[model samples]
Target chain A: MSQHSIAIIGVGKIAVDQHLPVIAKNPAFRLAALVSQRGIEQAGVPTFRTPAELYAAMPDLDAVAICTPPSVRHQVALEALNAGMNVLLEKPPAPTVSELADLVRQAAARRCVLFATWHSQYNAGVEEAKKRLAGRKIASLAITWKEDVRRWHPGQEWIWQPGGFGVFDPGINALSILTEIAPEPFFVTAATLTYPANRDTPIAARLTFASDAGLPGAALTAEFDWRQTGDQTWTIEIVVEDGTRLTLIDGGSKLAINGNLTVAEPMAEYEGIYARFAGLLDRGESAVDAAPFHLVADAMVVGKRETTDAFEW
Target chain B: MSQHSIAIIGVGKIAVDQHLPVIAKNPAFRLAALVSQRGIEQAGVPTFRTPAELYAAMPDLDAVAICTPPSVRHQVALEALNAGMNVLLEKPPAPTVSELADLVRQAAARRCVLFATWHSQYNAGVEEAKKRLAGRKIASLAITWKEDVRRWHPGQEWIWQPGGFGVFDPGINALSILTEIAPEPFFVTAATLTYPANRDTPIAARLTFASDAGLPGAALTAEFDWRQTGDQTWTIEIVVEDGTRLTLIDGGSKLAINGNLTVAEPMAEYEGIYARFAGLLDRGESAVDAAPFHLVADAMVVGKRETTDAFEW
Candidate 1:
């Protein structure tokens, strides 16, 4: 029941905007240190330039939250786990499934809780929707997640680089919600991924999925694009066999059933993530879900490539 | 045991060269029918242009072996499984991890034997090598699998298309052996994939792997390419902690220990594949190994993409 001493690694935008405030509010965790290369300093907290330095200085740290980009998260996480610290990973968890799988094993070997956080899965309406659709036979499902890269990611060069995941960086949030709320698991049957003429990653993608049992009239589709200039949309709609419709909008912060608003609340994805991580740490269990990552990798594996007009910031 | 009436779907080069002869020699399976678009007919066997036609005409078919290109294999395998027939999928399975996972689920629900055959895992010396390395400490491992796609594939255009897996089609065979023989599971850490200027898939790949527990001084690497014109080489070399070396050559048909030949035998990959499938069917169990496919998918997920000169058949 004692407060878990946690350090924040990679004090980037996400760490400041989401993690810091949440950790400040959570009673179960105390911010012990900050690790960042940018030399950002937090008042009343020890700051180190790297995870190695942080571990050396604060060997008693109970856990560390990694908010770095997917490309570099693995090394930092591995180091923390190796040092016997419980670890929490941000979305799109390592660049590849293999790296993430390795981390899971490492955490188990070290007896440290490794939580791969899918922030979107913690959206307020997600659990509510999952509860409502628990036994329903889904007839069809559709996900539309379109956002303007310029408006959201402004000037972030890593988004276009390999392992950056391009649109999938945001698109995976949708998949995380879908995988969490779906009545049953589904797999991608076909996909078409559109890449900017000059980039290594796709700017837009369309994927179709199917249930393993081939449910009658069951169809699922996910369309992700970074070209939306106005009225950015993030929505998932599922129709059950009895014609009951369920929709989650605003990135799963709101829920509506058959055109009637049921649950609309403020977003607290990161807070829920930390609370879950704390619970897992208390229970000595690792919560590393590979479904969302598997779907993203499957999209890349089967997606047909098409070149689009060059994208400019 | 009664002979299982099995149908061959998509009688391509692999089916003719490997499946036909293996089935002919296996006493547990009877080649009941053939399904193909090429109009190649086998004496005294009924032929259908499609799997649906074959299923309609012979509803009593016990099993089916799908040898179609991966892009189209999922649909055929799903159809066969839906009709309550046990299924045997060719190597690399059904294009993506999701598809293969779906098939495994479907077969389990239907109580049908679903065998995802990794033909190379059945190579003559693979088991012997696995036995030798079972309790050894691996210091390092290397896999070199280079072959001429021009000579092996000739004009197989499908190999260059999306989902074809390019060099990975053959590269996965190496992985099949690696996954089968390694003392512990390994995951990819980094990869570089080379794509032809005009192709959708990679023509070569280099990947590095590491164990979860950080095996003492252990390093693993795989190099796969389709440009080896002469002197086609498919070999795996492993170094143990005590300086003992193990090598598998000729696509795992031969094994050497400390530079001395330990096992040398003719390649009968497909024959072994059929024998394994028969055993699974007799035991009413589904044998589906997704490790090799998972590694390939991980490579694509984290791999840096580089464009090479345009490839011409």
Candidate 2:
């Protein structure tokens, strides 16, 4: 079997914690090069300060994993796509959906595979929920994605930046799950976003969605608070009209139905993402799901903004 | 051939100036009903207070023209579509692109037709320009769409609302034209949307687009300013390789090449809109373009907020 040589760009927390470990375990992919402003001291991979040099040095690299911040992802991905390289992008693909759209179009024109992976959907319970929710009427949905950013991200300054998505940093995981489990496609009917007094982005948002049926359409109200002190919550409650309430918790590594525990799996979201990307490459297909990101953009547009307590790192 | 009876909803400025007259003139459509809370004074047509009552009263009405504000357009459209009536929607389609997507899905499921019209692009010179520019290498484009809101919509409060689309109310018209005429799909590379301090919507925006080709993607930057004085500019300049600049002005009602004027038929945007709606209904087809609105929503989400001057009624 021919192995695909891949390069890693923007060696941030994800690159260190997830991509490196996942690539290490996946035999289908060979680590070819790495690019970061700050050099990664990890041996065995050729490190470069920029993407262009990495691509030049590792001419055998077949694909690249882009773990950059959303703001610069579009330009970097465009460069990679233009150079005839397949791409694996993190969630919320680009800073703007238009940029993601541009990248998708560019990838199509260049005939290169582009993967916009929503890692949270690769959780153990998510696929089960997706299978269960298909063709089933969804009555309502409630997601609580409160997390301690300081605990998870430590000193990550980029998450609080203009394009970091702030609270949506965790909220998008819920959205990715919601997009996958919902039977019908939905859009935001109304929303209210709570931005910190001093922050550029919102710290929490309450979004309401309605489906085409307009039959009270699987309403989702999410609260993304980054200041939780104890017992951090990351739960999604989905109530179907058939008296089934599926609660996915612990960042979707666990699932309980009607208060009965059913699932527990080692969370290998990054690994699953790479596996999916490899499957897409094997099939010569592009996996680009803008639906979840589209809802985020729409919610931002329709949602009212309120000032909340200022957040500090 | 049976003439379809159509009802006109939200008989406001656009409805009075465009829709009513167009319905009156189009032989395929007969203006059988008028709907508005403000009470339109058009003679020989019955008026209803709301879209629900309008839909309830006129089950036999084959089609409906929605000229309501963008804020409530999706609800009115949903009701109209659910009642199995063809719809003719004004520019920007729905308040947000996600809502429009839902409407499109709904329209598809019910086998009803929904027409999202771009009145500016319907102007005479647009088709000619598209024909002229086809297959020619487009080096860059600059679209300047500035109009005084005071001159057009004096007391329109909805334009200042969150869903009202701020300066994009007119900018989207330019986007519709650009999206239609461009040889390939383009996405907003970067944008800066300026919101008035007192308003929830953006008052002006500078948007840039790039295409798939490395040709700098027709550097189309659209600036929508509500502060334009006299002669009102709505012009798009396309710069070709030979230094030839093709400008389409007056909302595409006229064209000019290198500062020289090109002829255009008299502008009758609404007339063409009704004609197309009728044609779609006649052919049992639906034409809904959410691309322009998608860009607007994406821009709104990613564009950093900068408060500008406050405005009064």
Candidate 3:
């Protein structure tokens, strides 16, 4: 019932753009502090340079939202969980499944709620689409998530580094939504990952998936690229056996069924994330879904690799 | 207990070399049938071209040992589970964690035992090492598993394909032992994977891991390579906080503690695998240890990728 004091770790672009504003609007969470290497000063909140300093200064903090890149998320999240703080992690959770699994165990051992938040899964229309497609037999599905890395990510060099996930950093958002909406579990049957000649991560990928049990001739495919220059497209289209087609565009912020617009609303992904985090803390549960990340890992595991032209910012 | 009628799926090299012998020696099981695409005939036993035919011919079969490649294991396992037959999968289980997880759920739903056997964990000295390391503070660990791919795998083209796991096929055996022996769970911190210039999978990999709560300065590392030519090496060395050094060599067939030989015995990995599978079936439970495979998947997810010299079979 009381406001949960939450701190934001790694106050980078996402934190400034999405998390801060959402936290400001959500009465359930109060922004308690900011942890960053940069000497960022907030008008009315405390700021610390590291998780250790934040914990030391604000031992009473109820929770912390980690906005760091996936590479360093596990360490920061572990520290918060060990310090008895309910923790919320940004998308893609950790760089590896093992780290996320360890954090889940640690959170349970410490009786803390750890939420591996998939922000895109909280897009305004995601729950609506999930409800609509609950029992429908999916005849076919396609995900087209193409974005220009230059415009979206700019100079974030980490995106090109190993464990940065490159295109998967955005591609995984599509996967998260797909996993949320799919009626049955699916596994990657085949994939081709195209890496820039000079980068450690892929710049584009094509994935084919199949459900364990599906109608004859049913299929699922995803095409993800970081080279789209105009009108960044993020869309998922699903055709049901009953002839109803469902489509979610704009990273799941809009939904259409049978070629008719059904739900198109303003984005509130981060707000939903915080609300869910608060509810998890209240219910004494940990919401750590590794499905989306597992798909990404599976893609990396089974994906055939090819080198493409060198990418430049 | 009556002997369980068990069919061998994917009558490949492993099935012929390991599974058949083990099933023959174990009176608890009877070789019911063989399923393979190859039209090879085994004396005095039934043979079928596919799992469907095998199941169709022998609907009363009690169990099936799936020795298929990891890529196709899930499909076969699901069929067996759905048919109410206890299933045992070879190591590296399914190509992906999601597939294995789905199989686990399917087996649970059907009330059929699903055993994801990590045969190396059943190595002669592995259980001994696990018992000896229990409750001890592990200061550090190093796993060196280098083998000649040509010698071990022969002309196995799948080993170089995506999802074949390349060097990790052997490396996961070491991980299974480590996961069994470690006092606590550990997660990969950093990794370097070297793929051959012409291959989709890594030819060699180096990984670093750390436990969430361990002795100060504790560390673990693994080096796996497929290029070793002569005197193939498979070893794991561990140092306890009290300066006790433990070593397992010859793929866990030999063990030494504090530089003194502690265990040296012939391997019965496959026999042990069958025994565990039978035990699971008897107990109406599933033994799906995803730890080792999770480690491999995590390595792929986080490891830095480097292209090495082209590999020639």
lDDT of 2 by residue, B1-313 (tens): 4588999888888888888777788898888998989876678878998878977777888988888877678888988988998888887788776678778888999999889988887887788778777766677788899888888879989888766777888888898888777766667656787877788887788877666531653566778888786878898888876677788988898888888887567998887887777788888899987778877886777566667899776
Candidate 3 residue lDDT tens string, A1-313: 6789999998888899999999999998889999989978789998899899998898999999899877778888888987889988888788888788888888999999989988899887788888877877788889999999999889989888877888999999999998888788979988999999989889999999988335677878999999999899999988888878889989999999988989999988887888888888888889988899999999999999999999888
Better of 1 and 3 by TM-score: 3
By DockQ, the best candidate is 3
lDDT per residue as tens, model 1, A126-203: 998899878777878899999999999999888887677889998999999988987778778778999898887889
Question: What's the TM-score of every candidate structure?
Answer: 0.82, 0.84, 0.94
CAPRI quality band, candidate 1: medium
lDDT of 3 at B273: 85
How much RMSD separates candidate 2 from the native structure?
Answer: 4.1
By DockQ, the better pick of 2 and 3 is: 3
How well is each residue in B1-313 modelled by candidate 3, as lDDT tens digits?
A: 5678899999888899999988999988989899889876789898899888888889999999999877788888888887879988888789898998788888888888888888788876788888877887787888999999999888889889888889998999999988887778878877999999999899999999887435778777899999998899999998877888889999998999887888898888888888877777777888888889899988887788998899887
- Sort by lDDT, best first: what order? 1, 3, 2
- The candidates, ranked best first by DockQ, are 3, 1, 2
The DockQ values of the predictions, listed in order, are 0.52, 0.50, 0.78
Residue A269 alpha-carbon offset, candidate 2, angstroms: 1.2
